[model samples]
Target: MTGELREAAEPTRSEGATYYGRPVIKEPVWKVPDVPAYLYLGGMAGAAALMAAGAGLTGRPGLARAGRVSSGIGATASVAFLVHDLGRPLRFLNMLRVFKPTSPLSVGSWVLAPFSALAGAGAVSAATGLLPRLGWLSSSAAAVLAPAMTTYTAVLLADTAVPAWHEPYRELPFVFAGSAVASAAGLGVVAAPAAQAGPARRMAVAGSALEVAATRRMQRRAGMVGEVFGQGRAGRLLRTAEALVVAGSVTALLARRSRIAAVASGLCLTGAGLATRFGIFEAGHASARDPRYTVEPQRLRSR
Candidate 1:
């Protein structure tokens, strides 16, 4: 028998089928249904935190109260969806039992613990109409948690076996972090006037800079794995995000010319942030679809 035939005898593809290259061995553990729901809810929580902070800064007690309430509701809903997706809700508690720096889930659980606490405090402060009296302390706490809560999902996904996610680890966190900042800025613009939104605009600009830099780095660092960012659905979403972020930054910087332009900039930045999350999720799925992602990485490690 030929060497090809011998290799074919133990085919990589499913039984009774013959293909030259390896077929998919492991499929994506990250379900499609889980991705968007998680991303949206997390962003919502982050946005609420930003809004609450901006309200506190601008002396808008009512907006601060509303922002806190919204944050709590978002966090609660996010937890519900996460548990439902896991199928065995009890496993979530076990996630908190230990700390492993190498395990994204463990780290994320820790991040969530404080995030949830801050959200609850914000909710209580708002519900009791006490945020004004508590001063910047409550808002400051929320601000600190906002970025972590918003960005850690990227790490959670990256720590997994998925090739696209794992390979892009360095840039993924920054991508999510940038999105969080931009999303927060968008919320600030909607909740506060120009006086307070100035800081938000600056935040958005910083985020855009980070996002662009991280994306370039991802393209350079990821060899064949990075192909997803330049092709298919993932490519399109990324392209759109790039355009939106750049345009938004320019408008924000030049918004002194027009208020309508400033609003448009905020809208674009918000849209870009959403697109980045969706793009990353889609790229992970694409990477999982091919067996190369699974077998190659393992084989490399073994060697």
Candidate 2:
């Protein structure tokens, strides 16, 4: 009984409250989860802007009108979701008070403000039929902002302390861009007639190609935290994503003439995009829950 009491008196590794002797390695943090919602909406807006540019260039006024309307709606909706998630909507004005290149949220906010304005203008012009005169200007602006909108979400997420998200920074932007393009293409197919949806199909092909490449690189390059991509729920979702995207790409390319094939590919692309987004969210949360991801990397970097 005395020997057992001595063993119990010794401190085990678990006796320390926090990792490494620090009382508080990190404070209790709560970030707004709706940021991703804004990201998804912003991606849609970017794609819509690109579609508007293409439709205007192709001389399809009706398609252009649709694209403008879609872009405007997407941008407005993103802002609404962002504010709704902010906990205090009035504080949103502070986001516009300064320009901070180092701050992704600030930069994205400013970028979205103007992009939304331009998109709104394009939509109104299309509705009022004034875009014929200002087509070049609006199209030029939208084209420039389209890629940024498709990609900035990567920076936005990486700015957070989430291990899975931060470690895979190199590939996330491409993955997001690819997914955005695919989603945009899918939206195009749904909104426009088969003939006008040609560009959307092309976008899907390009986007899927990029997404596959980026996702593969992420799995290969991220060492440990990226391992989540191949484990548990994340692994299942990513595998399903790859299969669907590949099948959809093949179907779209080989079955171009078949409406059924086009529809199938579009649906697959949409599903893949959704899966990737949700999978990423889940993976980040998983990484955050484990202390190793947060501490080990920082220790190595400091050393």
Candidate 3:
């Protein structure tokens, strides 16, 4: 999450009005560790839930067990990170007291609550063989809720005034969704038996391709505002992520014959997914530090 802030140079006379190099939007108070961890884990949990559902329907018991366990672990960890970010656990509980359609956090709180419970139930069933029927129902419910849980955070961030986040709102969900798929597939590849790992490897390849494409498109459409993604620590991390994703996807295609290759591919995709989350977080900070990103876009629109 390291990022070096490089302020924009003074605007030329031709460049519309300036605001004394001051930020128009307040920088996010969210810390690096908590929010990014929440993002990554939530994505992983959501995708894992989907994988669990798929494995159940297809009669792949080994993959289904792997998915259930991963979903539960990821969902639990994501909540811990979120509560840590809030500084007080009660703040998250309070968010669930009311439902506000206009508020992503409010909606997300509702989403996470049921999903977490269901994920936990699924895991318990897998572990203790208790309430098998209940576990099936819970896993089904979680699979239905997973997509919203995964993408709502992107909408939450995009709802903000942060220049980097808000500008590419349309693509952010896809970016998050693809990352989640890759992460879950990575876990599946590593944990499931080789015979049942075929679908996971294919998913890893597809998700990696989608993530890379969507991310590049987001940066391209963001214009100068996206410069944060191309410089400093953010840039380095993103480049590394892209490389890993590409390599992992290729290796996954060849993993059917080699256990070692499957492990290697899984590690690569997992690392890439985590790196993408951190890179995006660092890029947001970089965008906020530069006043030009805040003011220039509005100046153009008004003209």
Q: Pick the candidate with the highest lDDT.
A: 3
- Predicted candidate 1 versus true structure: per-residue lDDT over 41-69, tens digit per residue: 67667667776777677786655655676
**Higher-ranked by lDDT: 1 or 2:** 2
lDDT of 3 by residue, 1-303 (tens): 223332345454534344665666778899878999899999889999999899999999889989998998899899999999999999999999999998998999999988998998998898788998998898889999999977888888888888888888888888988888998998898898889988898889889988999999999888778888888988998998899888888888777788888888889988998899998888888888777888887877789
The model with the greatest TM-score is: 3
CA displacement after TM-score superposition, residue 67 of candidate 1 (Å): 6.8
lDDT of 1 at 70: 61
Per-prediction TM-score to the true structure, in the order listed:
0.78, 0.83, 0.93
Better of 2 and 3 by lDDT: 3
Flag regions of model 1 displaced more than 4 Å: 2-25, 43-74, 88-91, 123-128, 131-138, 254-259, 294-303
Cα RMSD of all models vs. native, in order, equals: 4.3, 3.7, 5.9
Backbone clashes in candidate 1 total 0
Model 3 pairs whose backbones collide: none
- Model 3 C-alpha RMSD to native: 5.9
